[model samples]
Target: MTFTPVTPSDIAPGTTRFVQHEGAAFLVVRDGDGRVHALDGLCSHALLPLAGARVRRGHVICPHHGARFDITTGAAKGPPAHCGVSHYPAQEKDGMIELDLNP
Candidate 1:
């Protein structure tokens, strides 16, 4: 697995940030527990962008249409998004956010 390093300060705790690696878009989220997650940056229901999404209770709520997805498994947990987004492996190490988009 190839892990790309992202500046940890780019994203704050309890918030989501949109990022791109190689040619793929991803959402880097830090939940209330300070755990980091990497998920596909698009909402499955409408293919809408998930940038600036709200992270609550280990889930990322879609800014549009109120779809919710699990941060760890990418499972769609709410309406308007039956299909889940892709969840990539992510970790915080060496004071950086590392993610594997191809994993």
Candidate 2:
């Protein structure tokens, strides 16, 4: 679990932010309730960026093909994305959001 610290101020509540670390792209999302999640930046369906997608009820809808993925478990919740995305462990501590980059 190699965690990388990210600035908490960079992520606004109820929005998804794109970040890159060690040549890997990750999507860091802060839900409406303040819970933060990190997942593979690309959608499983079309390999499109998930940062521009919409987050609704803990699921992220792929902007390209309407594929929905659960932010917490990275489960494919709808059509087009039968394969689930990768979910990384995330935590907030000391005003910083730390993500497990190796996960």
Candidate 3:
């Protein structure tokens, strides 16, 4: 699988960051446990900027409408959110986080 290095693993938790590559945007946030989870930068239910959303309880909440999403499976977790976001495979090696995004 092809992968693009996004960010380093040394980043502190609770800090949300953005990564744009190949026309797709990625929202990378270091969870409370220090593991990084990257999801689509746009909310699946709406065109909201996910960078402003809260990363709580391992779900990316839509900053616009409170729609919740599961980062692990890219699935919508409730109503007002019926669409699922495209999730790329991610891996952390050494001290960097990488994502495999398809066009």
Candidate 4:
């Protein structure tokens, strides 16, 4: 399946927005490079919403347990969160950012 574009630039570079598609809530993380990436958006460790994660040191830091994840690849970088997140492919076209959730 394909991921949808559901946000704008006013939300800030590191800000995350929660989206519901097909009854599933996914988190979209926008990095400093102006690229948008999609992921499960929830922490695998404590099932906390990753959107609440703070952007620091090039990683999304989970607020629940301080779990950090790579925004691009959704890879967990430290303890309290061993399971990595799901990643979606994203691209920009015509001044809009779109994502492919299947990737």
Q: Rate the local accuracy (lDDT) of all candidates.
A: 0.87, 0.84, 0.77, 0.73
Residue 17, model 4, lDDT: 73
Model 4 CA deviation exceeding 4 Å by range: 93-96
By summed lDDT, the worst window of 10 consecutive residues in model 3 runs over 9-18
Cα error, residue 21 of model 3, in Å, equals 1.2
lDDT by residue for model 2 (9-68), tens: 467777888777777777888888888998888888888788687789888888788999
Candidate 1 lDDT score relative to the true structure: 0.87
CA RMSD for every model?
1.5, 1.7, 2.3, 2.1
- The true-versus-predicted C-alpha distance at residue 87 of model 2, in Å, is 0.5
Off by over 4 Å in 1: 7-10
Ranking by TM-score: 1, 2, 4, 3
Candidate 3 residue-wise lDDT at 40: 85
Candidate 3 lDDT, 24-90, residue by residue in tens: 7888777788777778888877667786767778777777898888877778886678987777777
Question: Candidates ranked by lDDT, best first?
Answer: 1, 2, 3, 4
Give the clashing pairs for model 2: none
* Candidate 2 vs candidate 4, TM-score winner: 2
Each prediction's TM-score against the native? 0.89, 0.87, 0.80, 0.81
Model 3 segments beyond 4 Å from truth? none
TM-score between candidate 3 and the true structure: 0.80
